[model samples]
Target: QADVLARATTWRDRLGADTPRVAIATDIEQAATLELLAGVMLAGGSVVAERPAPTTARWQRWAAERVTTVVGDPDVARGAPDAVTVLDLDGSTSPRQV
Candidate 1:
């Protein structure tokens, strides 16, 4: 609970009321995702996620349900307008943005 409190305080300080709805799309499993999710919520944001899917449609549904802001691999940071922010944790390279 201490960790949660600290994270929430930090989030309130950084974001104020501009809490973001986030989604993480990656191969990362649920257990591994909790820490990150907690961080987001603590910051007054929300998170939606699922295992990497074979189709974008599936991911799209999840994004819609959670109102995600970003979607990408698990190693790098990617930005999205509607979600909290995406991070790729596997250290993989993303395609060119253009």
Candidate 2:
């Protein structure tokens, strides 16, 4: 867990901002979400785990939460504003490359 948190710190730092709000949208079968959630939280960041097809209300909630980043499916990532960084975690266990 500590190791995962360390990696999360790296990801948080890599974001290059004081952003502490991250939104996760992915399938339940994926284990990467666990790592991502832990990492973000360990870095003192908040997380919003959303399903792939989120409703307008949910999206509004995300906006209200001040989501600074979206880490998961590409389509869901597109839901974020242009200023928000979208980290695609598709076809991989780690989020290093994308």
Candidate 3:
């Protein structure tokens, strides 16, 4: 847990993101996923775990959250605002465990 937190802090610092609102589609039950979520929270950021289909409702919800970053496949962030940071971690490092 401590290690995860440290890594999170490092990543957050490197990204220069303060209190970011991150959009992600991941299962919260997984150890790695939970660790990442914890890190985001600990860094004073927020997470959107579900990726609703691109629609008026989705845009409205995302607008309400003021999401700053979307992390996932390229297609997942296709229509996000230009102000939002899109990180295509698809097929990237998949840490199976914490």
Q: Enumerate residue pairs that collide in model 1.
A: 68-83, 69-83, 74-88, 74-89, 74-90, 75-88, 75-89, 76-88
lDDT of model 1, residue 44: 75
The regions of model 2 sitting more than 4 angstroms off are 1-6, 16-19, 51-58, 90-98
lDDT of 2 by residue, 1-98 (tens): 67766665666565444646877766656766666665676567887766444446655778888887777765654445667677765423223322
Q: How does model 3 score by TM-score?
A: 0.64
Spell out the clash pairs found in candidate 3.
Answer: none
Model 1 ranges off by over 4 Å = 1-17, 28-32, 51-68, 71-84, 90-98
Report the C-alpha displacement of residue 68, candidate 1, in angstroms.
4.9
Q: What is the TM-score of each candidate against the true structure?
A: 0.43, 0.64, 0.64
Q: Give per-residue CA lDDT, model 3, range 14-62, as digits (tens).
A: 3345888877754455555555566567668888656556666654678
lDDT of each: 0.49, 0.63, 0.60
Error of 2 at 58 (Å): 4.7
lDDT: which is higher, 1 or 2?
Answer: 2
